[model samples]
Target: MNYQLNINWPDFIKNYWQKRPLLIKQGFTNFIDPISANDLAGLAMEDEVDSRLVSFQNGSWNVTHGPFDSYDQLAKTGWSLLVQAVNHWHYPSTALIAPFRVLSDWRIDDLMVSYSVPAGGVGPHIDQYDVFIIQGLGRRHWRVGEKIALKQHCPHPDLLQVEPFAAIIDKQLEPGDILYIPPGFPHEGYSIETSLNYSVGFRSPTSRELFSSFADYLIANDLGNYHYSDPDIATRDNPAMILPTELTEIQHIMQQLLAQPHIFNHWFGTFISQSRHELDIAPPEPSYTVEQVIQLLCQGNTLYKLNGLRTLNVADQYFVNGEQLISPKLNITAINILCEKQEIHADMLGNALNDKDFMQLVTKLINDGYWYFND
Candidate 1:
């Protein structure tokens, strides 16, 4: 399903995005659920899927991690089962993410689907990332509080929650309604009845995380090799005291490493292009040769990019799943089509199919489980 989002992008970006909370009623008009609750539960049973069960009962909060074998012991009410990165494994669920492409793809995280029984909730909590929660199938009452400093505690070792806050926007959300909450906002939702909710979250990396990753990259690539040298030795008042001039020089040396655009950009492109979740990759049992792929395309076969595969372009360079493709012979148009579109065909490739280097690259990607023929 191709889901259509109804919201003003410019106005929302200016007034609401990361600034406040909003309840966009009928954000997806007549929105049909892309994946069923049964399917979500099934995904939770998979070893690679990240999932959890959260319940509130007996005046206490409880949390359980999955690959759950059975739901037989679960409470009829006051429990919710959540599966993260459903988009990676479920093809239909990826449609839920396509509409949000108005935002940058790198910043978009994954689709988390939760099925809740009556009175089910995880308690009031504050998140550091922005999220859009879309109500599906059944009704759920949601409450969002203003973004303010709040004390946090955990009833369960795995669960972190915030103190209850005064509700600023409180309402029952029906199917297709969306609640957009930015970072630092305290929010809670409980199922009025059996319900399903799809949350599309965005990634917001902290400076510490970025620096840590960059530092690791620098070390791995043998960068920042320059050593500090003070040729002009002026005797200080105390030999133990490091001069301010020496400190400034040391900082400049560190800054110079980041100033190299080529190295920095390549590292960032490779780093950010990686998916945070495990992908459902099934490479062909018998991989097709370059000539075989060309013949298939020529025979009107369509190629679809693997769902949740990250293919990104950084300054004319293309990176897929954290690996850069070396293709000096490939044209920008071909690269753009490969990076931008989910569906690729002979018409889209055009004369690029005739390019030997480009054909070999495509064949490599296809065999590596990044892309596959629709057949």
Candidate 2:
């Protein structure tokens, strides 16, 4: 599933990104689905997977959460099965995301795969995040409208749909075609035939989200607790009224926490690098011994990073699964590979293999299910 997109990255970002919707015909030439409909269904049944079954009957839209026991009761048409973060569970689908790394790894949310029957759709809706929808399997009629102020209503408790807007881009997308929709745009897709569509969604964390995350960080680290001490006791007319100077001083205490770029960078690096959805992590039944893992790596075996495992670096720090790995043992080359690639084979060892401490760090990762090595 090596994917290549036919578009100019800089121009697309400058002109169309978050500005308007663009329909790229044959975005991936002669595209093939990385995972089949049947395979997607099986993944949906797994308890750890987040999935949904959306069906429209007569005039009502019904939303059902999964792990569903059966889809047999669902109507033959007007139904779609959507599995979120499919890349976390499906290996082939993970490679489909390579081309989109241009959108910063931390901002990319996940690959959501939907299998739809004829006349199936989730209804016209607006999202807060940008998305690139790649048509797979069969044809789907997609209509995208510009970002506008529209009234919205909740047809189903789980779904908030917008009133239809005049479409700016409407067309029947064949396999390999892609429809890029920016955030806040009203858009809808109607299945013309049985189809599987892969959506690569980007994450735009709101101020609320960052505030919540940073607040938790402060509490966890016991920071910014400098007491409000009035060093110069001023004779105030009313003791109850806190002076403007005192309030400004209090604000600076909190502001000082963010002023040090290193502290915030470390906190953010760990925060954004964590997967929001349930990860498909399975440590070996009988975990491999350190020697066993090291031997495999030395023998030219690959250590495959788990899908959805967030490995990243900030400055000289390396982080995996939300915990920064800080050690004198950690070197630049090894950290770079872990942060950049999904798979690390023996040939990539370079000088890291010569360091015992580096090998041990990788072994610990394998045991934690962040990575695995084929025997």
- Give the number of the best model, judged by TM-score: 1
Model 1 clash tally, residue pairs: 0
Name the 10 consecutive residues with the lowest summed lDDT in model 2. 326-335
How far is each candidate from the true structure, as Cα RMSD in Å?
1.2, 1.5
Give me the overall lDDT of model 1: 0.91
> Model 2, which residues run further than 4 Å from truth?
233-243
Indicate which candidate wins on lDDT. 1
Whole-model alpha-carbon lDDT for candidate 2:
0.88
lDDT of 1 at 325: 83
lDDT for each residue of candidate 2 in 1-375, tens digit (9 for 90 to 100): 688888889999999898988999999998989999999999999999999999999999999998977778877799899999999999999988889999788889899999999999999999999999999999999998878899999999999999989998989999999899999999999899999999999989999999899989989988767787887978978879988888898888888888888789888988988998989888887877778876787888888999988887776678887898766667778778877899898778777777778777777778888898755
| Model 1: per-residue Cα lDDT at residue 73 | 93
Task: Report lDDT per candidate.
Answer: 0.91, 0.88
